[model samples]
Target: MNNPYNLVRKYDIMLKDFQTISTSFLVKQLPTATLFVDMKLRVVYASDKLISLFCDEKVNFVGQSLFTIFPELDSKWETVLKECLTGKSSPMGVQSFTDAEGKEKFYEWSNASWYDSDENIIGAIIQINDISLAIESDVALDKANILLKQQSELSKIGIWEYDLQKKTVYWCAMTKTIHEVALDYVPDIDKAIDFYKKGHSRNAISMAVFEATDKGRPWSLKLQIVTAKGNEKWVLAAGKPIFEKGKIARIMGTFQDINEEVVAEIKTKDNAKLLKTLIDHLPLNVFIKDRDSKKILVNKSECDYLGVANANELIGKTDFDVYPFETAKLSRDEDLQILETLKPILGKESISVKKDGSETVFLSSKIPLLDEDGHATGIVGISLDISDLKQKEQELRNLINVTSLQNKKLINFAHIVSHNLRSHSANFSMLLDFLVHEKDEEEKVKIVNMLTQASDNLLETLENLNEVVTLSTNTQAKKEKVNLHTKISEIQQNLSEIIQNNKLKIINKVSQNIDIRIVPAYLDSILMNFITNGVKYKHPDREPQLEFSTEVIKDYTVLSISDNGIGIDLEKYGSKLFGMYKTFHTNKDSRGIGLYITKNQVEAMHGKIEVESELGEGTKFKVFFK
Candidate 1:
């Protein structure tokens, strides 16, 4: 086949006319870049625009192979040129390559295989149009689509589309996954419509579609739907009509699954309602104020206390609107302090002035309400009416002061009695000595017996006074971690003689690592008192057995002393078990002060003591310590 350039050369006889026509009409009028290639893919002709953009200098490019002129096109140039030379037409498609300046350029090119007069293939004409802007726009669009898909997946939302004209529905992959259906499921209009819940959802969507198509209106609504797996869900559906010549042609819309968010919103509303009900039923007056200190919400108790007819009347009102200026100012200041500090101010006293000019004192606890940012946005408070309790507390304080004065007088009187008893006992002993020296045998013997009984009575009174004084003193015991196993072992060794004499059996189950914070001396005294008491009150009919064990409860340790001996009737002596001078058994050694002292020691160390007993069954004393 002859090259098209050769034919054009034959037209060189009219080259000047052709050049004038090409420059005036063809070259100047073409908006696109144009080039002509011979069968060998050599550039035979190129527009002035193409020459200026690609070649720069026209003489450097003419008669050059197209690939040589633009070597960067080596990737796709051979295949495209071969197709064109063979008379096969290809659709216009985008091609990109870098220029001499290293800047990228994109073009959509279309080529036609030119033929000679004999209908044989010759050279080809190529038209090029710059599509860089369009390409960039398409790239941005693709990126946006990818980002949108990612965001939808992250938020657990899925989108769907439907075309009314084509009667076809399309679902994104996420949408199918949300409905628990297969990706290959081809949705029909009827099947898609049936997914909507029966009553309001179906009716609303039907109405929306009808209106969008019939009236060319747009609609957006939240509706419920049942998935293929029998799970209920919430969806946000929107639709708009596509018009052709002012007539509705198609309706398109998106469906988004918003089940989780919708359900959470509903639950939040329900919880708020329940909380309001609880606050209203509370005995204390509960109120909340906005940043401006205006009442935003108040419980029924507050409304009734302030003598307001309804809660609505309390809105936008401050305490000043309902109380005296002094009381209102005090309340407002407390609230302001709470807000400024962003902390709770508890047990502050305030007065509530009634509409009738009567006032009542209240113990109020106010706290700042913070937003998600940790900034205080308002205040919430509960005011407890404490007027009656306040009056009783004042009366008790007065009585205590009077009682303290009486106690001082009693201590002085007891000291005088002690002095008198000592002096009398001395005089009686001198009198008994005088009687013994008198040599009156019968009288001397009777006098000596009376002196002995008098001495015993005096000693008993002194011991009782000492016990009373110990009970009245407030002295805290020193605290340290005491290992239970070691302590028990030491106490058992100390009491080994008594244990052997009584043929007693002792069971120890205290763990070695079981340590508790307590006064070591006080613990030893407490344990001795418990063990001796058990032996002293042992059942006459059976051998004595005692169990010593320790366990931990919450933040404290419980050391239990259990005895299978004579047990007191807890129903009769429970309250007096730890009271001074209270004794259950009639044992001669029952001082009754042991339990009282043990209880005080435990309490001094911030601990507690309790007892459980059944007559003739056993007695257990549990001492709890830090």
Candidate 2:
């Protein structure tokens, strides 16, 4: 549209002026090192900064090839210059080189072909930047990342990032391992969420990620994951939101495997439940106390007995706090004894004071509670109330004492009466002797037989009475520690004749270590009586087979004698089996006094006897002695 020559010339002049100004301003004010290169790759025009960096001298380097100025980059410089001058784009990463003085420096270079208004490539314009510190920082960061990766592998920790805007997920190698996925596996947001379990784990992770992305909230949670191989695991996850321009950009976090720890916690909870159930249902009144004597646990029965509202009220309170002074003092003393001994203290007498201020006696036992190192850390105790039984026993003892005193007086009177009767009988005998000489022989014979029968009856009654009195008296005062095996052997020797006559087979399983406190004479008599009875009651079809053994009961030794012979009907004669003159069998020697005397001797020595029998199977008698 500009056809006039004068106007065209003016426009051309104006365009030239503008180009010169633009180039001069760009060379002086550009951030990077700007340079112009010729066809030979020589520096044609360079900014003052570029000149200062490459050449210290002020002389122009217009005709010098770049390789000549920097010979260290000879071939690389020629190739890059040629590509740019041929109208190609060239980009390079930071590289280092030595200058003329051999000082090392780093730089980043970008080159593009410069064109004239005719659109023809003329020369190259190159942009250079000093990046030594930036390159060094990048190298350091790479090394730190390598170290972090090694640590994550060793600790089984995993890192991950989720870009909210792109809906993409990126995982580290350790993160893949935590998810039990292959190294080459590509995970997206949805696929990553699916790795979590289908229920709570998936729902929780989704919610946390959503909140982090939408509300910029950070989250930490423990969740469960189901692996590709159908294995379940526990993982601790923590994440923080990344923000750009006041909006969520990404979410990054770590994951740690905690399956072992979580499983252990679950097992501990289950075991605690089982222990609580056992404590609640136990029959005895049980309680647990801390090392400071403060009650930590009290069972239902214990709380009811104390008239407490609940077990919680009893916690942090000691026996002294809730009980009377006298009762608490005795209990404290017993607990101290247990601590001193580091052993269980059993059968301690204690009296509990109730809320109503009533006293109840109990037999209490305490055992030391041990800690992980097997040291006594606390105490566990059980109490059995025996107040009512104790009262009844006291009443029975008073009645028995009175009856014994009256019986003693009656025995003295009987002795006097017997003496009188003997004297009268002697006188009658003398008179009869005189009459016999002068009277009929048949009448004298009758009187002599009658007197003989009366004397025999009186002597037998006196012997029975003396045996009863002796059995009723206490014999434990003479008790001493004796080896049960030795005593049993001696008894066997004494009864050897009877054993042989009856062809009895005796099985003795008694150990020599079994020692018991009992009267020696009583032990001998008891064993002898049991052996005689076994032989006497032998069935006609089988020879007597006796088994003798001893075992330690709670606080005593029990001597068990069992026989494989005709057994008694316990259902019919159970109560009166040991009664005086109670005979079960009809025999010439069935006096039944043997069992009666055995029972009396055992009770006198503070022992008890129990029997178990069937009609024809066999019989076993257990004699418990302290």
Candidate 3:
């Protein structure tokens, strides 16, 4: 081992073997075109590929100068080659070139000084690689990636890559959009999972990742996640495991915005549930039948009506199973009419027999349920048992007829009584006149006064009866919009003389904007009667003060007339306050007809009259109108 001569000889043998092997591999089989040239730029070694490329069959290229081979190239190549000879390395670069025969080629080339056995720089080596197709393919791949990024953003689809080796996440531009995160946001595995909802979506994705990493599985799932902006979205997460060394090395997937689609699906399910709950709890018997006239749905009430234990028992059953053939046929005909006309059949009456063989009447409303294309898919029927309502309607009709007959008889009897009373009083007046002349002077004067009294009483009684008849007979008001303040002002002016004569002070507190629906003729009378009655019934102990005001309640406008007068002792005569010819006050002008007719007139205009009073204080009459 210490012998330098033997060491040198063994090293030389090994060096020669390496040279022979490397030279053969480079010259005959190396894919790259390589050449060696001396410091003077004359070719020393030329690979077969290089020689074939730069030299023609007629030219002996083994000793040819590189300048002659590429004479059209500039001095830049010489400078680079000379620099390589001086032990400077040339970086690889690509250039497009054309041969002398006008063919196009692309070359990636570099230069380095070749070494000999003595470790001294011998000459420069030139290496060239043809990358024409590779360059074109790289250009095409770049354009495709740009277009893909644009499309991903437009479609709201984001791509993500999970690197198992580095345990990091790559979020593409569209992934940022889906997450509503800033473009510059960086993500890790934990953070990405955190973006998913903290429950099912998170757990599912975690499991999916675990399965992919441990078992090399792929997964696609629709799930929900919370976004960076605090919005919740539905997304489709699909992952394909990329394997290296028989284990998952990466997972690539897509995140699609399925918010609209998922939300719509959720709403559809909610609506179906709501509809089911509503129909089941409703009291009305509801049923839906398909185009074949078979019941497809039934509510709880419909099931009970058909004597079935559950609603599902009635499914796919025809009405003939639940009712008589004739009745079922009639029902089917009505359903057909609804479908044919494509219109709802509202308030139709029909009868069916129950399981107990009892007849029941129904008021049914049916409509065709149409699909999106406007084709009728089925009929939805809603029915109510109207037996009791029909019975009550008949009773109401009979009562109305009886009341009408009685009213007519009462009117006739009143007219007859008036006629006989008028006739008798007329006879008494004539007789008294005859007797006044026939008797002596003293007797004649008494008889004449009696006759005049009889005549006056008869006329007063007739006039009151006429007023009552007129008030009672009219049912509807000849209505117009009557301003409360304007009418009150007009009534005050009309009764100005009496108001002044009686020392009555009228305070009209009603608003100018308060208006009511009332008969124009009746409005004046109503206000006048209230005022005159107030003035007439005023207690002698105080001055008559009348205040008119208006207030609005729910759905009604109220006009209140208050008086500080001798309010009637309501406990004594409240019931007769508005009674016919019932007078409680000692005032000579207190004809009970005034309040009675006021009541009738108020009612005819669809208004209500209510009074609040104290015996020695004041009476307030509030009229409520719509």
Candidate 4:
């Protein structure tokens, strides 16, 4: 052999040189950011891409050490490169570092040793790739998957898949929890269908699945189900068939727990039905309208007033459909105003004239209906029939007018009668004086005496008649604020002697603050008459007692005078108790003129008198002052 060792060495040297030249050219033509390094970790050749990534410009970096070009490279990279130079292994992995600009960068390196023709170890070749964007993308994808899982759990939504080919099913964690099953529980198509409730629910879900798998149709339904713990629940199940090569491959969808929402909706509907029933039976004419002023709801009373057979006849109808043109226009205008102002029009009197010339009066009220956001939606109206009341009020006014005219005429007649009686009494008295002066015989003297007594009685009657005329003429008495307590006290003082003589007990329980609108003189006279009557009608069995009190009822202040005395038999003499000169007692001072005059005084002041009495019980007289 000419020299076997020398030939082997020479061949190895030539192979190394050729490998260097070809690898350098290949590195320069690589697509990614790649570079080749020698056994000493020095850059042998670098691609245009690598130079642009690590260097500011395309400078000569062929002879520079890898660490010198990238000074921030750590010891982990050195160890990887040195082990790759052994030619026993090729290490490929990613490494990260902060570059000169303080930006994080990732490099994917594939390092291996180059060999000669004799298979001897040579320098290493490192293909470095800038994988920063790919690394960041992978990190973001992982975070997104974690967040989606969390959101699905919180929303009570679970994903599921059914594989037709494998005849198997997959349930996410939330799906298992919804079914009240163990996390590791495995399910099949048949088993999944069994979870649905019997009858309607099971049939619905079965049909849905059949359509989805057979016809590639999608289904979303709210159905009931029974859990592993035997609890009934409402769930929203949705699914779609996945097609592959024009054939159904699998079914994938979501499952959600919707029990609370469905139950709430059912309860709300029940409440609405109850409210409708209640409103329909109301007696007053109640109605609800939409924004367009069309009737949406009406009660039976409303239908009756509109001349409809039933409430259905008036549905979706406007006022113009039921009422005359003028009446409908006025009602519509009021509805529009309430809607615009969001205010209520309460207790408004409306008059509707019929075609036959009859009129009906109604007290109507309208209020604005608002939505949850406080925006006006429509109006609610109520009307009450007041025609009968109005008619009665008019009739009362007419009667009052007629009574007033008659009273005036009666007062004028009393004045004329009293004047004529007074003149006749004066002439008769003069004739009686002449007879007394002319009489001398016994029979003449006796006749003259009787005539003189008759004349005296006639004069007394005329004087009392004058008093009545004077009081009747003052029908229009001026009213002023009078304190009841003070007037009662003065009357008591004026009648103190009579009160003491009969040992009468007069209790003034009237409130000091009780004031009434009445003529001052009339109050004094009324109090004086009541007090005197209480003393005059003293009972023989016991001591006389009088109680005075007051109360305010509605618009009237009532003064009550009660007495424990000999009472009148109202059933026997009630009608004529207050008649002129009527007396119920045998007492010498028993005169019914007091009550008659008291009633006249009260009526003149626009007040009234009510009496309650029994045969043996006490009497209560209530004076109502307006």
Best by TM-score: 4
Instruction: Looking at model 2, report the run of 10 residues with the lowest lDDT sum.
Output: 405-414
Candidate 2 off by > 4 Å? 1-155, 329-344, 372-375, 388-626
In candidate 1, what are the lDDT values of residues 1-626, reduced to their tens digit? Answer: 99999888888858867764664467534666888778888876677777666666637565788877776664665787688889887744777878788989898878899786589988888888888888999999999999998988887666665676687778878878777789998887678778899999999988887888778889889999899999999988877887778777777666677898999999999999999999999989999998778999999999988877899999999988887788788778877888888879888887777657897889988889999999998998899999899889988886686478447636754774677577767868787777768677888887777787778867885776565466446455457887888998899899999989998888999888887777788889888888888799999999999998888799778989999988989899887787655788889988777887787678667678888888998899898986
Clashes of each: 0, 0, 1, 0
Candidate 4: lDDT of 69? 82
lDDT of 2 by residue, 1-626 (tens): 76699898999999999996787677856666787777677776678777777676567676777777666663666677788888777774556777787888899888888787898887888888999888789989999998888888777789899987788899988889888889999899888889899899999999998888778899999999998778999989889998889878899999888888899998998997888778777767899998778899898889888888789999999988888777787778777877778889888777778646898888889999987888788899998888887998887896697578447635753774577468657766775776567477777777777667767755764676577667665543588888888887888888999999999888889998878888888888899988988898888899899999988788768899999878999989998798656798876777767887788788777678999998777899999896
Candidate 3 displacement at residue 44 in angstroms:
34
How does each model score on TM-score?
Answer: 0.52, 0.42, 0.39, 0.54
Ranking by TM-score: 4, 1, 2, 3
Q: Determine the C-alpha RMSD for candidate 4 after optimal superposition of all C-alphas.
A: 20.3
- The residue-by-residue lDDT of candidate 4 on 413-508, one tens digit each, is 566566657766676776667666764677667767777776786676667566666677887778899888988998899989998998989899
Which candidate, 1 or 2, would have the higher TM-score against the true structure?
A: 1
- Location of the lowest summed lDDT over 10 successive residues in candidate 3: 405-414
Worst 10 residues of 4 by lDDT: 405-414
Better of 2 and 3 by TM-score: 2
In model 3, the runs with Cα more than 4 Å from the true position are 1-155, 267-276, 294-297, 307-311, 315-324, 354-358, 371-374, 391-626
